[model samples]
Target: MLWGALPYMVIVFCITATIWRYVTNPFSWTSKSSEMLEKRLLRWGSLLFHIGIFAVICGHIAGLLVPIEFYHWIGLSDEAYHMGAVFGGLPAGIIAFAGLVILLVRRYTARRVRATSSVGDWLALAMLIIVIVTGILATSANAVNHSGFDYRTTINPWLRGLLVFQPDPALMQTVPMNFKVHILLTFVLYCVFPFTRLVHMLSMPLGYLRRSYVLYRRRDGAIYPNQNQEQQKERAM
Candidate 1:
């Protein structure tokens, strides 16, 4: 019964929070990069995390959104599909988790970044890591089993039903614990997102193609030479 209500509840909660966030603080919809404080680790970590996450999202779209019949229709067997997911999911999860670790380390080690960090940042990162770890646990467990947990049979229908405004809690109730935990955490993330920097995901700059380039210039009256002695050697003599 709990599972039955959770889907609709989370959907409503996310929708309401999103609406409120957009209305109250539209200007705060940013990821708030700390590139100026530290760029080297940030560059690699951000790249890996984004790439892995994009792949993971794509994988979920293929698995959850696409029905089993579609695969069979395209001459793909269930076993083949499961094998593909096992191979694809493991590396993606690892990459994403590794990147998150790097980002977290950078946040703690860099003085400027650590000074600006908030509780929201830590909470968001912790939840994200939990979601990824649970996901990988589910995938790796299924890979070792004699038969993979065919989520398309259970979780997929339930999710599709939800998309059409129908809630089928029974479908998710039987899902493996790891996968269920992953799903529940995901919904929880929806609730927390509006209050955190995670909202930046929704506001990604899709208009970049049409936007003009930003120009930045260093302010004058600021000393550029690292050593004042170099510029004032004559005065020293």
Candidate 2:
């Protein structure tokens, strides 16, 4: 009951809080990048972390949302599907872990960033690393240790049940300890996500794709925007 209910409760609270935050303090909905203070590590770390996270999210969606019956229908045996999960999940998890290491290092070493960092920042970073580490361990157990554990039969259905409002905690009871840690931490991350820089995710500027680009042209010694507006007001006066 705790496992099933906790995730939904966290998600609901996060959604409600996120909406309130965005509505009341829209300008604060940002990642608040500190790249200007230190670009060297930031560039590499940000690229790897974001890309790895994208891959991880994709993998999670496929594993959790797609039904196991679908794989059987497609003629993929359980062993084959497990192989695919290990092969795909391991690399992505490792890349994300590496990037997270660099980011954590940068967070502490960069004087300006460190000075400005809050308790929430450190807490978020620590939890993120823990989640990634546990996830890699779970995947590695099957890939390296050859335990042949299949999460499709366990975690996947539990998640689907949660989606339909028929959460069954029993579904997650048999999940490995590492995997349980991963799931708990992930939802905890979701709960904290709105109050942190992750809130920027919701404000993705997708409109930029359809919006017209700025066409810069040589304006000689023409006034800037504010100056141009001031001149217009003067003429009106």
Candidate 3:
């Protein structure tokens, strides 16, 4: 398993580095255009995508950090958890998938957008789709594996340990190959975030709001000097 993941990790790291270089020097490209439609699409699409992504992250964090007892306390029995996983995860996945598809279609289908889009932009969208789709598959498969020594319960702990710098092959053995692929794709997306247009993910929406127009006025106004005013001034002098 370790040997298999090595190639993916290496590719992810390389692509990540390349993306970072471009992001840091985006201004090197002399030509760019801004359209209101594109701006609005980005604004709203980003909002939905960010909110949904945040929820997904929170769900993952909860699974990893929250104790089973805590879940039971909140009226989530193992059965409830399994059912919730299916019902909750499927719709969320579908929504995320839709958002990603819309963003991608906008990039390719819109002439103005396509003109300004870099290779990094398309690649970022593709990577996101890959990650989301794989996650959806993993979630669906997890429902099927609930009766057995499940991948999430057995393999995820090992992967978590690896993330924390402790690798365990025995625990990893429980993870299905497809699950590993999903995990790897996600890691690749993370590695690429700082380098691609995806860095927008890290930007503050408050900045957009700040750019919005605010009204203000000068306390005093000076009118332009016309011929009449000049003659009047001359006569007074």
Tens digit per residue, CA lDDT, model 3, 86-177: 78767777677777787777777778888878887878889988998998888787677664444446555665665666656676565677
lDDT of each: 0.84, 0.83, 0.66
Clashing pairs in 3: 19-195
Which wins on lDDT, candidate 1 or candidate 2? 1
Order the numbered candidates by TM-score, best leading: 1, 2, 3
- Candidate 1 per-residue lDDT, tens place, 1-237, comes to 556777788878888987888898888777888999999889988998999999999999999999989999999988788879988988999999999989999999999999999899988888888889989988888788755478999988888988887878878766888788888888888778778888877765679989997654336422543435663575465
lDDT of 2 at 10: 90
Candidate 2 backbone overlaps, count = 0
Candidate 1: segments with Cα more than 4 A from true spot: 204-207, 212-237
List, in order, the clash count of every candidate structure: 0, 0, 1
Question: Candidate 1: lDDT of 17?
Answer: 88
TM-scores vs. true structure, each candidate: 0.86, 0.86, 0.69
- Model 2: CA > 4 A from native: 210-237
9: Cα error in model 2, Å = 1.3
Over 119-202, each residue of candidate 2 has an lDDT whose tens digit, in order, gives 778877888888888888878865677665678888899889989988888987777787887788888888888788877766
